[model samples]
Target: MITAEGLTKRFADKTAVDDVSFTVQPGRVTGFLGPNGAGKSTTMRMIVGLDRPTAGRTTVNGAEYGRHRAPLTEVGVLLDAKAVHTGRTARSHLRAMAATHGIPNSRVDEVIDITGIGSVAGKRAGKFSLGMGQRLGIAAALLGDPHTLILDEPVNGLDPEGVRWVRQFVRHAASEGRTVLLSSHLMSEMAQTADHVIVLGRGKVLADADLGDLVRAWTTLGVRVRSPRAAELAAAIAGPAVEIVTTSPETLDVVGVPAARIGDLAAERGIPIHELTPTTGSLEDAYLALTGESVEYHSKEIA
Candidate 1:
């Protein structure tokens, strides 16, 4: 498990992270999400001790990451795939890393095969593609068979097959009771992989809860209604919190109200309703709503 309490970081004139606290337990995959310049990278760096927190503390398996005698065996990290020696082959790189903690040659072979990099084990990392580089980084992280895994954009350069493989692999790791903290911009993949989510905005915690609960908490319940008298129904249901968007002449997307309420309101006004479907919103919708104001960079459309 990993724990952070009152974590904060400041770089000269600006605060990158602020008073963040959360715990990642074993046997589950926790997703870390945020927009650009939201301090996600900084927070991850602090967790692995790459950047010292100005205040508070973070522990991996109940101890500081650097304090562990065999740090690789306690926590596996894949923050950067290109942090390897470009001159070395995949096999040579793994061999050197294993030598550091006295890891066996057999383990290196195991990880190479586990990450599906045996075909290129003899190739130099500099010549490898982005996807191949990511695979090698994962192999190194798994070299020690650590109890916890921290991966940032693990599928950045992967194809569809590779992406699916990573999703299943992380889920399998968590099922075996290993703590996994994953950070990604792929909401669809995160929805399928993570059991919980922690959303950060402008270096502060925005929402942390079960995946479903977080979405429901940030987005208002909405309904899609198809009616012959759509305009009449929309007018009847208009209120302070409700909004009606007409998608077509006979269809309307109503927000801030439940399906049952819309149906009742339409029926009361004698509107001929054909369809009334409820929508609970998606992870992307909730993410945008929660971090709308926290986005640091915005592009203006050209006229």
Candidate 2:
């Protein structure tokens, strides 16, 4: 497991990570999510001892990452796919990393095959495409077969097949009792891949919970109503905290009110209800609702 207690980092007058604390347990995939400039990269860097924290500390398997004699065998990290030497081939890069820890050539070959990069193993790292570079980086991380894995945007440039392969690979790693903490901007993929989520906004920890609980806690259940007198029903239900949007002449989307309340109000008003369905909230919906105020960069609307 990985633990962070009051983890904080600062660069001059700017604070990159602010007293963040969380645990990434073993046997599950924990997702780290944030908008741009939310300090995710800094936090991950601190975990691997790349950036020293200004205060507090982080530990992997009960010890600081740098304290381990064979750090690669304790934790594997893939912070940047393009961090490799461009002059070296994929095979040479993996071989160099393995040689540092006395990892055998057989293990290097195993990861190359496991990552499905055998065909391009001899290709120059600089000439490889983004997807292929990501594959080579993953192969290096798995070179040690560490107990914990920390990957940042592992699927950033992957194709659909590559994305699925990563998903399955991480799940298999967790099933084998390994700790996995990964960061990604792909909300849909994270929803499908992560067992738990930790949300960060502007260097502060906004949320940390199970996937289902996070969705349920942040988004309210909305009701979709189809009635001929949709406008009338909307006006009747309109009150403080109650929102009603007219999607069509005969349809209304209601929020801050339950389906039962909407149905009862419609019946009492003698409105002809054709459909009354509850809309379940998605992970995207919850994420947007929670981070709506914390988003730093906003795009201008096109006129």
Candidate 3:
């Protein structure tokens, strides 16, 4: 539903986004992930016509976002939940946004109710909590009932319940063939919410693939073995794929190899094995491995 070709954006001498290209397809939630200075917000802003790209361009459907007669109806964006006027009531905020597209007052109430902000509809937005404010922003975004949603760090202040709600919300929207592009730096949250993941580093695309098959690095995919003779077991398969980091005298933190092989080696050498377990990799590990040298700000003391 959304496509970008060689999209580039510059600020002064620094390139915020550099020849980045990707697509957000319909019927799935695509995650846009990167480090703090990795141009995620800039890319999102460009997609919604908030910021102009220095080179190349992106299109929602077949036309540039600016060319769309009803942009609000084409794409619903929640770039900044706090961008609302504090003096206005929640309902008033929705009414004002709906007015832009000439949507009726009843539609405003529909979105307000859909976002579960009916009780706070009359309350001043300045007095609302962060989660409540986020709901209000989502209400505005949904007011248009757009087919595409571009949300940047949407779950920032949401509680666990609200977070779950947002996740299901996106999934439900995508299930109906809508396109969703979500940006977040939180690896765990993205792991849970995104169907397809795009990893970015230093204003460039690092990895863009399905969330189901994150690169092997993201997950060490190792097996753990607890044998009585840990020393003998370590000596048998002492290769690059097998590393026995010391945790305790009786236990070894084995990584990079399968548990079955470890068990086979142990049984062959008469080493008694006690425990075998498989360990999965985390999104952080995968992201770090993918962008190890491409990070903009590396710690001089270590990395």
lDDT of each structure?
A: 0.93, 0.93, 0.86
Ten-residue stretch with the least lDDT total in model 3: 215-224
lDDT of 1 by residue, 55-156 (tens): 999999999988999999999999999999999999999999999999999999999999999999999999999999999999998999999999999999
Candidate 1's error at 280, in angstroms?
A: 1.2
TM-scores of the candidates are: 0.90, 0.90, 0.90
The better-scoring model by lDDT among 1 and 3 is: 1
lDDT of 2 by residue, 54-171 (tens): 9999999999999999998999899999999999999999999999999999999999999999999998999999999999989988989999999999998999999999999999
Please, what are the lDDT tens digits per residue for candidate 3 over residues 1-303? 999899999999999899999999999999998877888889988988889999999999778999999988999999999899899999988898889899999999998888888998999998999899889888888888899999888888889988889999999999999999998777888888889988878789988899868746466676666777878888887897666776667677787667888888888888998988887777777877777777777666965
Candidate 1 least-lDDT 10 residues: 261-270
Question: What is the TM-score (0 to 1) of candidate 2?
Answer: 0.90
Model 2 lDDT at residue 93: 93
